[model samples]
Target chain A: MKIGFDAMGGDHAPVETVKGAVDALSLIEGEIVLFGDELKINKELSQYKYDQKRISVVGTTEVIENDDKPVKAIKRKSDSSMVVGMKALRKREVDAFVSAGNTGALLAGSLLKVGRIKGISRPALCTIYPTMSGASVLVDAGANAECKSRNLLEFAYMGSLYAERVIGINNPKVALVNIGAEETKGTPLYIETYQMLKETDLNFVGNVEGRDVPSGKVDVIVADGFTGNIILKLTEGVSLSIVKELKNQIVKNSIGKIAGLLLKRNLGDFKKQLDYSEYGGAPLLGVNGLVVKAHGSSNAKAFMNAIKYAYIGVESNLVAEITEKIKTMPAFEAPVENEEENE
Target chain B: MKIGFDAMGGDHAPVETVKGAVDALSLIEGEIVLFGDELKINKELSQYKYDQKRISVVGTTEVIENDDKPVKAIKRKSDSSMVVGMKALRKREVDAFVSAGNTGALLAGSLLKVGRIKGISRPALCTIYPTMSGASVLVDAGANAECKSRNLLEFAYMGSLYAERVIGINNPKVALVNIGAEETKGTPLYIETYQMLKETDLNFVGNVEGRDVPSGKVDVIVADGFTGNIILKLTEGVSLSIVKELKNQIVKNSIGKIAGLLLKRNLGDFKKQLDYSEYGGAPLLGVNGLVVKAHGSSNAKAFMNAIKYAYIGVESNLVAEITEKIKTMPAFEAPVENEEENE
Candidate 1:
């Protein structure tokens, strides 16, 4: 199987991306197709020794900066690494695609180029956040900002499948993110979504409040893209702020600094657990092909992990499973019809 | 000025509530009217000694438990401590009302009894969250599930006034919370809210992402109730989880325990900074009368701090200021018209 990589994406592009590709090629039995400016890719590749036959480069002329408008960047910078990588996935030249470039651009290109699954109205970006118990998957993090109840139910189905297949959780509990845990406690969409999810065959855990997300109470927490994005970013901010405060306290005085040294070993492990880059990448679910979005600040280790996760996505046939489920599942009744009938 | 306290509210009711009232009465020069079962309140109040003139009791026949539905609980349990305290606020017998009871019930009671300020579409529960730089206010935490752009502008107006007058932040920076910091990154409602906020006379900071809330980058972050509640509770969960994880790490081994002991002083300071209860209570803004909602798990210190905040709200004339501003400010133009005109 062949996997396409955006070699010029992320903070440590080309060099770290190349190193990661080399490492993945050695460990996994797959062909690596690197997409970027040929000169930069070759320069980074020269330092690494690996099976040359397993690694190949596709030349691209431009890079999408983080500040560029997602749709505009994807359209104008057609020869950019992200577009090139996604085009390969669309053309079936590669089985999967991975990029740490502009997140919005990756999401936009995946939908516009690689396209969504046949029956899915909206695609979701699912990210695994570390919790004390393990990790929890939050879907629609920043994908479809405004969603109906049917869209949220689809997110649940996709998220539950991803958690079970990729994250290795059996009968993963799915919960709708709401202000309160009661069925009638959220917006009309959430209340309606709660009803729909309860009717699904998945392990629907009813409504879960925002406080329950970080506690790792459920395996999958689904929401509209707007609230899901807020939860994801807020969790990241709180974790970073706490860690920063902890570090500040640890080195404040002589005794504290001494304590810091004594606890340095444990601190490293804790930091790793909080690190998003360690999770490899987030999957753009409901898409027709496997597309992984690595953190924009990813280093070589994170890039390597993203490749590993991409391999797992392809090997586990996540996209096919999601597509099949969407096809076989009961069609969503028209929202207006359902509302009128309920009344 | 007299302040009404729901003596039967919260997890540590009667005991902690009475202790907090005693503390407040001793420190602040205000009359405290404890509202609850006369016998139970007096039994707990007997533990503290203060001027008899400073403390009094108002009898209530019922109590509202945490699980009761807000509207139903308020309607059926008219003589409950929360309802009795709100009644005092409504009758002008007290300057403000403070409760650590069911948040929904307090919010419902505040709106149903005290009424909304003229031209205010919805009252918001605004909370001052402790952050690295200082505290930032989040409006419409869970009061109104669905809010329009007009409601959001009013929230911004009230929140700004509260921050400036009560929190003493001059020219407070107000932000509209969105999935991203860009002007066009959120739903149509956020985009419309952004335009409305930009036209306002307040110190509008434009759009802020969810992560910026905890960073204390802006003085006030305004959003529709759903997103605001999610951000608020997610922050709480993430903060608690991190602290819990830190404590777990600190107590894992004998060496770690020794290290924790060595750093105990600094850790204590850190914990205090992260503690939400230290910030006192969240105010139910836009109400005609002052109302503060304390955390349900509040201890004596938290309850006292909330009472102190209520006194500050009354002294600052926050309600009067906000009401006057709303009356004088131009009526909100319907956003649908503005969007069409702009297009």
Candidate 2:
């Protein structure tokens, strides 16, 4: 097995990505293929001592920037690390593709380059949301801005399958993110989606409000990408602000400074639990091949975890399971027809 | 001026509500009219000493429960504390109405009982979003679950006016809460709303993603209630969880416990900063009268703050200002006609 790593991706670029790939080699038996500028990749690779045979490079020239238009970059920058890595995954040259590059570009590449599963209407971006009890999967984190009830139904099944297969949560509890717990709540889309989810074979746990999201009571939270994106970004921003505020409070007084020193180690651990890097990356589920999008500002550790996450996705055969279930499931078949009839 | 208070609202009921009213008397010049069970209001009020002449009780037999259907409760329970308080506000018997009661009932009563300002399409529930710098107003927090582009335009104007007249911000930066920073991003509704905002006299700061919300870069965030409700609840939940997690981390070991003791005051201050109670209540904007919806689990401090917030609203003549501006604004006029043409 081989994992395609975008060495030119993330804020740290080849430095962090190369270091992360080298560190990750010890944990997996699979080989790592670095896709980026050959000289830069090799320069960073030389710093670490590793089994040289297990690591390889497929150098590319163009780099898709953070601000680059997602689809435009994917189509235009053919030799870019992201596009090259995506092509490699599509061709089965690599089992999974991992990148900490532009999230929009990666998602666009996943659909345009790697393509989608035959039965899936839209592939969702699913993230591991760290919670008090454990982690819950937040689907369609930022893929589709507007969604239909059919799309939400697909996200629900895909999210549930990912939870069961990759995350290993048995009979994963799937819940629609709504303002109220009742079926009557939310817009026409959510109301329609609620009825669809209720009849599914999956373990559908009614509705959950935004407050219930971090409680980890449910394994999978299904939301339209617009709402999910807002949730994703807001959670990150609020948590980050709180942690920064804590540091400020700690340095305010002489007594607080002393307490900060004594509690530094515990604080570090607590921050780690809240950190996005600890969760690795959000998987672009329902894409024909496995694609993992690490945070754009990822460090070496974060990149390493993302690669590991991609490996887990490949090993668990998440894509295949979703494809099979979506094709065969009776619940999945009805929504498409119902939607068409409505239109 | 007189303020109508729901004595039988919220989790703590007459105990907290009556105490809050008593505590609030010294902060304002207005008389307090407690509307609920007369015996229960007096029973709790007797525990506190105040200017007896300033505090009066108007006994209402019915009390709107948290679970009661909003519109139904407002219509059927005419003698309910919420309904009665709303009626008093409509009739100019009270300058404003404040409650820590069923939010849906309060919002419904504000629209159905007190009514919307003339020419206003809809009244939004706008809340004070506590941020790192200070606080920003989040409009349509949970009023209209679904909204048209015109409603959002009104929300933007109303939210901006609330920030200026009530919150005392000069030329408050108004922004649309969207999935992206781009005007072209988001659904067609948001795109249309974006163009409408740019044409207005408002200090339109362009689009803001969910991450930019807590940064306090903008003074007013305009969104559909479905999205705004999620943002409101999620912010509250995440902040609460972080505080709880910090407490757990502090008590996990002996060294941490000592640090926790020394840092307790700072943590307490930090918690107070994040506390929803500190912000008082979400005002039902665009309504004919001032109606503030306090938190459901509000204690005396929260309820007291809500009353003070209502007092400020009355003093600023917020409802009158909004009513006047909305009628004169050209941006407000165009969209209503455009929507009609499309239909």
Which candidate wins on DockQ?
2
Q: State the lDDT of candidate 2 residue by residue for B1-343, as single tens digits.
A: 8988898999999899999999999888879899999998888888888999999999899999999998888879989999989888888999999988888888778877887776678789999999988989999998889999888988988998899988899999999999888898888889999998888888999999989899899999999999999999999888888888888888899999999999988887788789888877888998889999888899999989899889999999999999888876554455332111100
Model 1 / residue A16 / CA error / Å: 2.8
Query: Which parts of model 1 are misplaced by more than 4 Å?
Result: A332-343, B332-343
- Candidate 2 Cα RMSD (Å): 3.5
Candidate 2: where are CA atoms >4 Å away? A334-343, B334-343
Report lDDT (Cα) of residue A336, candidate 2. Answer: 41
lDDT of 1 by residue, B1-343 (tens): 8988888989999899999999887657779889999998899878777888898999999999999998789888989988878878888999999999998888788777777777777789999978888888889888889888888989999999989998999899999888887888899999988887877788998888777778888999998888888888888888888888888887888888999899999999998888887877888997889989998899999999999989889999988999888865456433322111100
Candidate 1 residue pairs that clash: none
Deviation of model 2 at A77, angstroms: 2.6
Best by TM-score: 2
Tell me each candidate's TM-score: 0.95, 0.95
